[model samples]
Target chain A: MGSLDTRRLIVCRHGERCDFCFSTHRFHWLDKAIDEAGRYQPFNLNLPRNLPKRRGGYDSFRHDTPLTEMGYLQAKLIGRAFRDREIKPHHVFVSPSLRCIQTAIGILKGMNENHTKLHIEPGLFEWMRFCRNVAPSWLTVDECLAAGYPVYQDYIPVVKETELNMNESLIDFYDRSHLVSKTLLSRYPTGNLLFVAHGATLDTCTRQLCGEAPRSNEEFFEIVQKTPYLSSIEARQTGAEQFEIIGTPVPPLAHSANAAYDSQYLTTPGYANNTDTL
Target chain B: MGSLDTRRLIVCRHGERCDFCFSTHRFHWLDKAIDEAGRYQPFNLNLPRNLPKRRGGYDSFRHDTPLTEMGYLQAKLIGRAFRDREIKPHHVFVSPSLRCIQTAIGILKGMNENHTKLHIEPGLFEWMRFCRNVAPSWLTVDECLAAGYPVYQDYIPVVKETELNMNESLIDFYDRSHLVSKTLLSRYPTGNLLFVAHGATLDTCTRQLCGEAPRSNEEFFEIVQKTPYLSSIEARQTGAEQFEIIGTPVPPLAHSANAAYDSQYLTTPGYANNTDTL
Candidate 1:
């Protein structure tokens, strides 16, 4: 009704991954709460953390984790859903992470809309980690192009390996993620858009577009913990300053994927399916 | 390990409600997207908005809306979870809204711990709304005490119906919620603490604790849309300047109920859920 300052931002969490994990990283305050509680042995969290990562536990690593067969299917499902609705995004922006690239490819194939180009936006990459060892290693533009996805030629890599500069806190991530909307709103004020990124991005963008308050670290942990692959939020502008949730249509991946389904996904580089794992 | 500045702000979203709605409030950009192709069609959102008491769709009002049976059970489950873990919150803070009051009661009863008191905090109330038509009608201290929950003796009411003073914008809410941590960190510096309030409180408190950046107007909508009832987040102080998510252990609400289940909740007190709607 008003001028076209309104838009839709369909934010997607990349499909499942071997390294993009929550199972083993299950949070335990007992280790950190000791300092925050300002008391010792106040209570025991008894977090069954290491148990999930031990001998019978899973061996998880960071970066370049490929999607399981299930992950590809999940992405494809989202793509197919888009096609069924005849909703073709004006522009699709993707995080350059391995999983995101794969998910984006799956979505394109499913949509079967060859017209819209994929823009490799590193700005939508995973939250900048303070822990140097766990920081993301994004795919280069050249590599992404070689992988055969149509990447925006002008896209520049925002994240750098040598730079340890980061927003180590969820607050920092919130700030960065919050900015993504400002940029998106300004760049494409009246078009339906899609963002394929990580759990944090999904949480931040979805929360932001829905007019919800920023999340606390505690809330964030829970949000990311259950962010199943393909989980998404649909935002359609109701007014210049208002938007509405069309829905969250993440078809269930597997009822027991978190604990039951753990198919081995490729972990190393130069693999056949580079789009789904890095 | 670190100094007293360390803290874990566990934030909780109040339970389900008939009014915490998303139906009918569906979204739209225009009626159609002409694209760079600029065409137009009347795309109706088909929202099933309630027709009651509407001059033209906005007869917004606010008061205490009690929790459904399921909501009560959900809160109780969270309390029971804390008790089972021997996790005792040294201090518990509650928003003055009725649902929050009810939820705080449920959690306390389930905790089965008698030492602490429920602080009826207005600072933790919903971001102040400037629209007089939608101002919150909080239960009087006398009314709350009569309801049988332990009301903080020193607690003072902050929001006034006659006064226009309030934090109505997301920026305002963010600033106020951030201050909540400053006050808590200053006063309770070292102890397990709990915050019980609405979806906005959950989002603001959690984001603030995790040290997230300020939110713009666009980011706020998506955040509020899918705030699941009984949803929660756990914060763990990793160091004075660092915190981690321990986990979100709120068991599924439908899983069970406590022996002390009370069905005749105060749902008809010239009140509806004041929160969410505003």
Candidate 2:
């Protein structure tokens, strides 16, 4: 094999705040609704509010938002996991989104690997959430019922509407997100590949790779079972033409009491149990 | 207009260097071929072949690859131009490509503009030129004939081959380049917009805005002529949702040639032209 041939694909979803700290913050209720409906049923629902008063609307402030405290720990765990396994990546592929970029930077920092080349691709951005300040609220119980119950089956449709209302869609996000991994795989085939992406993108990408039926965003998180973290799919390139998924592993973290303390500050609570105490 | 609307788009191409300087020096003959043909055509053609050697390649040496003396001068010119026009951009978009990035930094250095929010978007990258080490002399006249004539019509095919042979393509480049502008436009409708991009992307974008057919890579330089160092396109958002191209204007230099020389290096032809003179 050529010295430059890529050997392994190391995939990592970007850390957590990206999921919770959207522009409108109104999506918190929507996320809660989905979480309450259980992980199997998908349901579409409109956001109760219009655009947040942010600059980029929902997508604004992406560049300045840092990883939450939980996010930092998640990255550190992934870095340690790689170190424990003695894995060294030749190149790093990252989403330009602030959360993913920060996660990639943090993971590398934790591992003390400073010199790897990081290529930021926009295709890895998270699914778009349409936010309008004027979006009508579901004030009455009947209005809530008309809005439809949040079912796992309705997740895709709801996310699609959210994107459309916001002028950005999950399908488009998935399509573009896949391009990020595809570009990385095609360009740097045999290397430990790490993709710091949003939860929705990571969910969609993993399902596509794992060949599962479309999963709701909530169920997608269940596949990894960690909040504000990284998930890995170990794939071996058999030749220049093929890739074989060898294992999908979510590295275990050393539980600490502080984990719970950090979780309390997140915009969304109860997503994960934080047994760790300060 | 909304208080946050982007009133203008400031587009500028990267600075100058010889092909050898950009790692593209090996294709001097191809550049020469295009330039020769451009003289007879209505459009201008001034492609710089400043390709740098592969990073860490055996032949790579510690030669100074910093911006040239002309490049610095060009950057200052752009800065002064912005200042003179009293242009203040809310957002600055830059191509992640080295030359364009450096150019953006240089120009920003001279202006009073805030640099805290500059974004390096990879989507704004120029047309990709794959390196093929084969000598032009080795190819026969017949091979040149097989490659087709040096008209704008034939340029895209050859450029495509050059990129594909090296795993890059103009089509992908054009699409990606356009994505940067589109993304920025969606977010910043009425602020002053600054884009530091490649000559090719700027050219294609300029042509597209002017309602011309997509020009070939060689012809791109024609539509967007290069200045002594800097070239610019000024555009304004009009009619609520449309952008109207103003004009391509060159930035004025702050210091005259004599004053600039007096302020900096001791002027001499060889020394002034030497990139290492810095």
Candidate 3:
């Protein structure tokens, strides 16, 4: 019990997404997607209105989505919030994606620690579905390091075709999330750990912690209202085998300027201002 | 059945080990190690006699055990045999270990195809147990390319300490091996596949094909007599859900010169003869 209180987890969703993802907003099929019985099940193909079209015969940019400028600022605000509260984490973890990297970098800046060893966990990468597994020419570890991000020296992403499991489903992702949870417990044991990843990771990882997620539709929306834009949840290990979400999830609505902020719209400060040279 | 016959799996274990693994011969407990029931059960702590003593307080040599000269030669011989028999694999899969790399390289040389793109699959790495998880200085992917081996341009190893599941047991190893098998089937569903890895991989992967591994003491020895040295097994996917072990597992005794070979000893032609420099 004493040790459980010492170990805490800050499960966070990466800030707003690339223009590619945002332009294809939810009004097209989001309500329909939720209304369908498929939402209760896993891996049901819920095609949205604005699915990014393949750029060409072999367009890598069709995927490998990056965080928009607004997303960066949201991450920055979260990092600043931690700094403002004097919350010093023993380690910071992020997924191996451009968006997560930018968000982690922004958060790092907010924490005022440029050299914090940021671990790029491939397991935390956004769930692959509907052929979303095909990645673009990803930024290399050296590029991350050169770009002033302190990605761990040994960081490596899954690259080989054989390493990419094709039959991966939502269940598989959930299993991986369970694996990640076990890994966290075994490695950190006792420390303030920060995780910057995806919405699925948040749901799955938190489920592994407290054994359940926001089950009710209203509850799910309530917990995820600010996610993928600017949301964070705190899970405190209450026992060796138990965890309790301590702090409230600070979703985007609370951090953003006003209610006028379009909930469905992906607000960005524009790409020109954000130099994403890769 | 026709497709199954064409789509076969040739699972081969890496050959031999460096002086570090060899000098610590079984007078410390190799022979007796297998004799115990703990062997049948799994997770038996059988520390080798000469378990490479650290050269100093920090010695990376303790774990990144490379292959010896004989091991390389054995791999070359297997490659030559495959080439002689005209058994050309469309793709070559190998673990990202120095020994596996050396073996794969030696095999590539023997096959006379120096440019075959090798996929470094971390899923195929030697099983880890105890503190053996703490890796030694691993050879980088760039080093492989510099050494003239054609590694995939986008090969990346697994990262993140928490992503490394510490409580992994033999069951976990089997699960991973099963994942590797599934990956092999789904990725190249209709091609001849080759896996170059360790004995445990051979054991678990074969189990995925047919059914179980050898359980009896003698049967276990028979199945693994020459594994991790120079041995090969052929598995043909019989049905969508069935497989047949076609060719025999070519154990070392059948390949090595005479009965004079010491099977228990990690055979080497001396490090002076085998280059270890990356």
Candidate 4:
């Protein structure tokens, strides 16, 4: 058995999502891509090349969007960096969101670790306040398996999706995340644990595990807003049932956004005509 | 010889640039990443994994920066899309900018076209107004070759770097690009040609060939601003020397900007302490 001191936990945010980045007040790719005849066509390169079949149909993407191309790439790069640095996670747990599942897949592909399967933990999902007091219609374990994701077929989650407190306060959210973290850590008891979820998971899941107090709503929002996609935090086991928050194992990924190119600009008349050259 | 109807020309903008995306007025990665000892270390994932050596040393990145991680991926994806669609470019020409050269390399890699080499052309560069009346210290063809780029070392440029009109107006920019376009198409009249350069190259190089007038500064700027990274335009030969500007063969790439994550928020106090859960 590995020493308890070596046991570590990593919490990471999912990569860029299509809805938050591409959708406007009046239009969204999810709505525009699907034809009345049920044909799906992606209009932009940053959008997902394909989407997995969902129980709620394509409309479910409004609540649970997939990662953009760069989003997947960001997660994959982080995985490659971890592989190069020899930081291996023995067990992987991810939020039930499609973006989170895709991110976990990208990381595993990057690390070239085909053997490790992901545990789809609804307990690891983002704050319910952001979800508007309702559980996101996430894909089931069977659905995820059919989608070719390396999900553990038999691993049961500590906190089921239906049991999530959609009306939970900030304090309740912290307790729930802390409970999940503790349950998973205690259950495994050895090797490293990696969590691929939302921005707040980096804090909520490990904050109480490190014996830190829960943050207020304003504080929690501030942390979530500051956390960019694929940002991660690491925690090391310091004592019995205790962990200390360590710095990230890799440098945080950063890049400016790419704007959608408008074809109209090619012929849009602005001001004046061709002038003579010097 | 291929039919005149089958001959094609594609003009493309380079991928996301490191300097334009990551640098602020106060601090630039080129200066910050290099220590006083001249050891180069990338502080972020979006910055180039490694930089090619230059005659002006690491400081040269100020004028010629490499592509961000997503930038390279965007170009590669476009290449893959083109390859999938069987849109093969028999010859490729690239601007002297590091980003443009790197983009060409990415596209070639994606298309699995190892036999083709890039012809670095200074004439295809963006407007001199943006260059501030001075030539950017670009990597020599030999320097690029030494850096493992597949460059056509023996191909003499139609317009040398020193010949670029640093003080030229928008009309001059269009005319220069037009001359280069006409010269290249006339010289190699059989196969398709692909030019990877700046956002404006999609217009400046092909507009005149299509019998369109030079765009005014206002008009040119509008087009340039709307042209996202890896944006492309195609032109096909019509009669003898005449060509018609066709629309893009692939979907325009798009995504939102990624903000840099600050670690301070993790520990920074916001408001109040942990309250009892509901």
Candidate 5:
């Protein structure tokens, strides 16, 4: 007890996805403009807008599109925020999804080379999706935006259609998360740690850390936003078990008026200023 | 850039080492004592402690020891710290040294399971005498530690020894370090990045970032200490070159504190609180 310092842990969600495609999008306007221009756009041959219902209703879950450029930028912002906070972690564990991997890489770019070692753990991936899952006709992007929770009944059927799909239940994800966390906690007990995961997984972890399930979409958002770009949680040893809570989230930028600020549209100051004009 | 939020990057140092052997000490004193008392110590022969030396009787470099039990504990502490922080990086780059690898693994145990991809870049490895083509030496530990930094007068001779034993020089190391950093920055300009590097290599990057060489051991210590456990640096873009120095020397733990917290002599907090028993 005397040898180890008090420990801290923080869990955060990856940034937003395209409302329509669910892929990571980089340039909202470029995509919008491309869609409007309509002529000579890539994928026009395969995905014509005026196609009949059967063909036009392509199953998005079957596709593995890379994060949109904007999504990559969001990840970069997360990375930059971590850098600004001076949070040097001993290890970085991330989910294997392309978006998560990209996010992890962007964050690493913003950090010093001395402290971080990255590992890709399959167990930390998003809850598995069963095959041939489909979104119900009643599901709407607006509903999702307003509710901030996956309308599983509407989304599950559409997802089940994908090849190699594996659905991970909340219980399954929770169990896996607990196992992974426990293994790590038992092994390293104290140091800077980072985990890049999906929103659902983050939500599950949030519930575990907070001792209550998140009650609303806004609450989830608050939890994710409040989750530090880099933060800590104290781990206490009680009898045979160790207990810890996800600590407060730390934003990378300062809370001052001059500090970088952004909401949905504005990019963070550090990233915005340093962006390459490609 | 207008569409994305700012990102953060955090970088931190790995943990302690064995004072006597320079190996990573895995078992804290308490663990060791318990193992010894239980007669469950691993079967490891006490090999001879011969140090490498140059022609002029000055010690040559050597960096191939494994982590001692205490070193393992230090790595574990670092892992816990990372877990507490909830930092999830995208890419993890590591130097291929025994100590660093062990440290990386220990830290990974504390992080998310999704970070499974571990890349071993030879360039990220420590500056080694063996790598420079130097011949083997037969000296004692005291002789090696007492040997001052390589002198200019001994350059040719050392180079020749390096040729024979594959030992690397400071200049060779510097070039390698630069290449590693440059390559990564170019490849993942806007990604989260994490690197597990050697002490000398980390020092070199810090020096480059701060635009000054470490003038003294004290100065070096201060620089490293001030480094955030996890922090980001903006990628500098000079025409085709895209990288920035967002952070500086992420230090190892304090020397004095480390000295007082000797792994061999003290008990680990998790196992027991009795220093005497250890």
Candidate 6:
């Protein structure tokens, strides 16, 4: 058990995504999965078996995509790590992006905290510039609930979707994230909290809380690139409005990807090219 | 679903393993997870939540470690891939190793073939040299069933545990695998058969069926090292006694591992290292 005054927050990025990992300039999952008949055929193993319906059709996944199978496993591993380390969070907040929401689900399932519903905060979404100055149509709370996600239906979001500024600068994005972090801390007062959001959430939310100015646009981009999928950071509140970033409780998970095996290579030099005796 | 003469076999290696991935000469998971108190405490995220009881004790895991979480996911993904491609396996055979058995479980769950029980074959086990010229004590079918694995109760393996030759040469190992493959194909003459086993199983079992001699020991070792986890190969019987290796139904799954993030890196250099206002 933590002390009554202890306040800690851990922020994590979403897992591997299909669009970012598999999409090419000419080809995207939206084009491959949904055919002329409008039927979804999963041609790839990484693609999700079921995609949740959004108001703006499935093409909306161009900006907002679901996590790959490995991505979900990565998130679940972190959640299990948290459970192994006994880093219990009293409140869990998430970005409304499908990837983050799916990551939160994997994490909670890993932690065996199935009952803890995720508080989807629109303020936790990534920078507007990444979304091409347009907010992606995220799945609504009702849509998420209908899709069997464990969403906190009664709780209101810190930032409404309509309030999101598509033209917000990098500094403005940082300020928004800081405000949401601060507001959540104030509301919770004295318990561990978890945030499942984008790569920049680690810096955007915690930098100002630790009394540091936001990084320049160039530096922020560098930081985002360095943040790997399922990477996490921890911050502990020590005094009034003061928090210190600390080492994560778990070690980073690592594994090499398996390449496709071509059976042609398995052929011996002297063997009959065609083995069948017809 | 096919002509009565159709006979297809798919050979797959087990998923990622904890021992191979995490174990070192100085540090092994067996020592860390099990304490002097004889109680198991999973210190790492990749460690299994519960280990099945074996006569050789937990140390038995030194030779037969369970699959990592990623391993399970890999197997399940392959299963899902089979489902996606509509490649149904009428029968499944697994190596007696714990990793292979666990992988079989994940694959079956992914294929949604919960009713399909696994046939544990000692003959399907890896080369004796790899096990250091000693047959390791494996989890008995009863023990596996008690642990809730879907093992076929009535089926008897072609090779018994006591029949394993610890001093078998490389050629002998190939012959053993070939015998097992031949026996299985003869038993199930028409339906699609799946073998969930070791790396060399792909070559060992199918080499003779395809009318090829086994590779030299050096070549064999190289092949094993090159064979990645969850890699699979497919072979179809074209004649009464002839089989031809062909392309797998599903593409290989790929993803880079995420590196762990340290919170110390997030601190701005100019800011106070200590944020607390004391």
In order, the Cα lDDT scores of the candidates are 0.55, 0.44, 0.54, 0.84, 0.39, 0.82
Q: Which lDDT value does model 2 have at A150?
A: 16
Ten-residue segment with the worst summed lDDT in candidate 2 chain B?
A: B256-265
* Residue-pair clashes per candidate: 31, 50, 4, 2, 155, 0
Q: List candidate 5 segments past 4 Å from native.
A: A1-278, B1-13, B18-63, B129-168, B209-278
Ranking by TM-score: 4, 6, 1, 3, 2, 5
lDDT of 5 by residue, B17-51 (tens): 32233223564322332243443222211111122
TM-score against native, each model:
0.38, 0.32, 0.38, 0.93, 0.31, 0.82
Better of 2 and 4 by TM-score: 4
Instruction: List, residue by residue over B32-51, the lDDT tens digit for candidate 1.
Output: 21234433321211111111
Cα-based lDDT at residue B147, candidate 2:
31
Task: Report, in order, each candidate's fnat.
Answer: 0.00, 0.00, 0.00, 0.67, 0.00, 0.49
TM-score of 5: 0.31
Estimate candidate 6's alpha-carbon lDDT, on a 0 to 1 scale.
0.82
- Candidate with best lDDT: 4
In angstroms, the error of model 6 at A242 is: 3.8
iRMS, all models: 20.3, 29.3, 31.8, 6.6, 20.3, 7.2
* Chain A accuracy of model 5 expressed as TM-score: 0.51
Q: Quote the lDDT for B18 in model 5.
A: 29
Instruction: Point out the higher-scoring one by lDDT: 1 or 2.
Output: 1
Model 4, A1-278: lDDT tens digits are 33788888998999988888778777887888788888778877778778898788888888898998889999998998889788899999999999999999999998999888999998998888898755689888888888898898888898988888778888988999999999999899888999999999999998999888998777777777778898888899988877887777788787776766555456556422322100
- Give the alpha carbon lDDT tens digit for every residue of B1-278 in model 6: 43445678899999988887666677887786788899887655556778888777788888898998788888999998888788899989999999999999999889898799899999999998888755678898789888999898888898988998888899999999999999988887768989999998988988988898889877787677666688788888788888888856577665555544544557644332233210
Which regions of candidate 2 fall more than 4 Å away from where they truly are? A1-278, B1-6, B18-65, B130-171, B209-212, B216-218, B224-228, B249-278
Query: Model 2: DockQ against the native?
Result: 0.01
Write candidate 4's Cα lDDT for B113-220 as tens digits: 888899999888878788876567899988998999999888888788889877888889999999899999888878999999998999999888988899777777
Best by DockQ: 4
Best by TM-score: 4
